[model samples]
Target: MKYDLIATSAMGLESIVAKEVRELGYECEVENSRITFKGDELAIARSNMWLRTADRVKIKAGEFKAYTFDELFEKTKAIPWEQFLPENAEFPVSGKSQKSKLFSVSDCQAIVKKAIVERLRSHYKKTSWFEENGPLFKVEVSLVKDVATLTIDTSGSGLHKRGYRVDQGEAPLKETLAAALVMLTNWTPERPFSDPFCGSGTIAIEAALIGQNIAPGFNREFVSESWDWIPSSVWDQARAEAEDLAKYDQPLDIVGSDIDHRMVKISEENAFEAGLGDLVSFKQMRVQDFNPKKDYGVIVSNPPYGERLGDRKAVEQMYKEMGKVLVPFDTWSVYIMTSNENFEKLYGKPATKKRKLFNGFIRTDYYQYWGKRPPRDNR
Candidate 1:
């Protein structure tokens, strides 16, 4: 059935997420921090498999302005819980309230949970004791200026857990960030791409997948696969679609390098695990040693931003070395994701494009540099 679905994304990644939704042939209405769309079960499955920038996909159950506890109890109970939840399923609710008639979040959570449980008890005649063994029930309650909105999370775990990167070094980029960096570039399998500071090989692997058009969820299983309502045939169909998109014989020139030999080894292992060893290459080399190939491509990296690796001075030197190595590739476009405010000074130029982003709790920025100016005619 068509339902209101909201895909939550990182602060600055909302536009990218909206683009992904639109590419999937869905009409999305963009909001402040999320995108709202209406789709069926297949849409849910597709989002879980393909959305690289979204944090969670939530299904709207119901919404209303509850000026009092009594109104909240009645409105929440009216939501059709049985259609999505089994008679024997156990569910819970959690909420957050601000500037609303109901200001206490804890109280709101307890009330919503009680209302849902009561509705299920009467519908199923489940007067006896019951245990909650079904898939996790994530409830979101947002009260802004006295209006309350509730949604159920279809994805138990965030989509970033692609299950391939079991091993990671210090300050590794999130899988979502890696995927975003790939999407932000113009790299294709016909050309070459490189990451000089490829920690754990996230960017290289993401690029390989992008080149092959393989679904990001190919290496992992999502929590939605366990829901009783979604049939196995649907999942099989999605898997088939993903497999059909995979081009095992596709040509690609992707390389990852790191000064630390151990990180290089980790990257190799990850590529081997993801079955991308043939498409991507990993090496233990410093930034100065990397020589550009003939075909034009992209260089995207999440370099260490003076955190844990060394002091501020050493980090600046490292970025300088990175710039020294990257500046020689006249045909390549370089993108750096960092939390350092002085990265522009280190890199020696104001970015052609700068976007504000967040890496977990750290406020970050994505800096893009064009190695060569475009022709006057093109401009």
Candidate 2:
């Protein structure tokens, strides 16, 4: 059976996620931070396992207008929840509200839960409480202007939890955002790639995965794997497709470096954990000292923006050093994501283009400096 699915992404990455969904052979509608599509069980399995920039793969169960509490309960109950949830399903409802009559999120959550329980209880003919010892069905109720949209989370953990981050620095970049940083650049598998602020090597590791066309979820599992409706054979075929498409033997020129030796060690461990230790290199090197000999290389970094106390002076100095050394490499493009508004002045060069992105709660700008095109044979 085909189900309506939505892939949630970061604010500025809706188009990117939509492009990926289209690449997966699905027509998608892109909204503020969500991409909606229709697919079957294999679509569910492949989306949960392949979408690199999405936060979560959710099933859009139902949507309708709800003004009163009674109306909310009736409308929610009207949805065919039993079509997805089994007799022994353990469903927990979460909620959020905005510009709606039901301003109380907890109240909305409770009402939805009760309505679902009532419907399920009647369908299953259970006189007692649900045992709650079964596969998990995470339900979410989001309200906007009295219109409620219900969905079930297929991804238990956020997609950024690719199951390979053995360790991370204090301010590590999210894996989904890291992959977006790479996808936004012109860096292909043949082009050299480096991350100067590779705190946990997330950027480099994601690049390696993309370089070899490996599925991001290849090393992880999703919550829907336990749902009986989606058979093991569906997952098996998805894995088999991933295995066949992966470029395990492909060569990647990727490196990650950090001034902190501890972070360097952590980066190495994380890369090894991601099963790309042999394909990528990590080292203890300052951003100012990184000297690239190859032309047409791509440099992506999530540098310090001096948000924390006592980091302003040092971060400014590093920015100056980067400006002095890197801006002259006309043949190599540079991309930096930072909250520092004075980055252009400190870097002594204006970016060719800039795009706004949010790193968690911090608003940052992605600075792009496109380099000269490589020779025909070199490309």
Candidate 3:
């Protein structure tokens, strides 16, 4: 039951996702936005249930080059569809084409769907139309520079949907991206963690999860759970492993604060929804009022970049205030995500390092200011 598994990530988080995959005991190949590895059913369950930064976990069915519709059909049909899909499986084909001869996405979808139906019909010896009333198997055919890759979606909703966040702010960050931001920081459970712009408390909650080593998808259900080919015992074993590994007794000093009282309440509600209310705290406060009580702490914030009209001046002033208060804490590492090009000028200092990351479609820079490392004995 070895399968080629691919974990898709955000535009710039391939390395982090690949690191996570390797940590999960799988050797992975890092591509632009996907990490491919050889795995089995247990790997599928473990990947969907644990990869905090991946968007989706898919099983790569096949890959080939296609120049025309006939070639597409034949190449697609050559795949052993019967090995994956059952007779009554509700498989839907989605397609996207880029710089390829098959420029028509809808046409490619239709042709692929027809070819899969032909293959299934021949395998099952069914003359009537497929009922498609059984388990779901979502399929995608992506064409990049005339090379086609076909995959089956194992994660129903994106992994960012951790089934939490009953409420959110107008510009809340994604759960996956928040986790990535926390992972990028030099933070540990023994140190204090804070997010000044705690929209929906995503970063703080993700930190709490990381601190406790809890599986991100432990409380969520995935689409592949309904597939009959994967035994329930496999999922149970994965869940059992997750439950056994979680350090629930580990205390975390994590906090999230926001200027808006409404957002503060929303953050608290979302944190509780994620089962992290006891481990993390949320409050209403402005970024200027933030003061860390612990040395060698970490601050990761996703402040408003003033992408909207007339908010640029306010955001700039906020950045200046962030520099005024947090920068002077030489023992605290600070990380900020913003799209402003003049962030260093506004923040009053150049960053130790900067990384280019995409927050959805907005191009942004992650400004990192390294702080003094704690003494070995103190650490």
Candidate 4:
């Protein structure tokens, strides 16, 4: 059966997630942090198993405007929760409100919970209390401008937890964000890719996944897998398709390095866990020492942006050194994400293009320095 699905993303990556959804053959409506689309049970399974940059995939249960507690309860109860939530389903209500009459999030959550429970109680015919011993259906009630949108989480954990990267360095980029950075670049599998400040090797591993056409969620599980409404055969089919689509034999030319030896080791471990250890090379080296032997490579890094005073001076020095090392590679493109406002001045050259992105909650800019294409002979 077709369902309204919403793929949630980071604030700046909605378009990317929408593109991914479209690639999956679904037309999507992109909003601020979420992309809503029409899809069937298989589409939900496919999205949960393939979307690399989305945070979570949720089923849009219902939407309405409610100004008062009674209105909220009645409107929420009007939704056909029985179709989605089983009699014993453990559905917890999460809530968010903005610019709405019902501004108390806790009250909103409690009201929604009561409404759903009431609906379930009526549907099941005799329910003093639900067992809640079955699969989880995490419900979210979000209010914006007095409009409430209810959704059920299909992905139990965030998609960023790809079950890889058992360990990570300090301030490691989220897997979803790292995947977005790689997708934003023009790097192809044929071109060399490097991340000089690769913390726990997120970018490199994501690139390897991209290059090899490996589904990011292939090795993980989603909450919907346990939902009886979506037959297990649907998930089995999605996984089989993912396995068929992956190019395990594809050769990848990706490298990641970090100044800390321990981080480098962690990067290797993460890559190994992601099943791309042989495809990505990790090294213990500073950004200044990075010198790619291959011409016409791509450098995408999330370098250190000193939030502390003591580290600011050293980070600025490192930025300057990065300019010294990378500027001379006229044929290699460079993309760096950092929060420093004066990154361009310190790097000694203005970016060819810049895009605003958020690395977590901290606002940052993706400095893109486009390079001349390699000679035709190289191609």
Give the per-residue lDDT digits (tens) of candidate 3, residues 149-219. 99999999999999988998878799999999999988989999999899889999999999999999999
Please give the CA lDDT of all the candidate structures: 0.82, 0.94, 0.94, 0.93
Ranking by lDDT: 3, 2, 4, 1
TM-scores of the candidates are: 0.93, 0.98, 0.99, 0.98
- Residue 267 local lDDT, model 1: 96
**Worst lDDT 10-window in candidate 1:** 370-379
Candidate 1, residues 217-253, lDDT tens digits: the string is: 7777776677788887878887888898778778888
Worst ten in a row by lDDT for model 2: 370-379
Error of 1 at 5 (Å): 1.2
What RMSD does each model have against the real structure? 2.4, 1.2, 1.1, 1.4
Off by over 4 Å in 3: 377-379
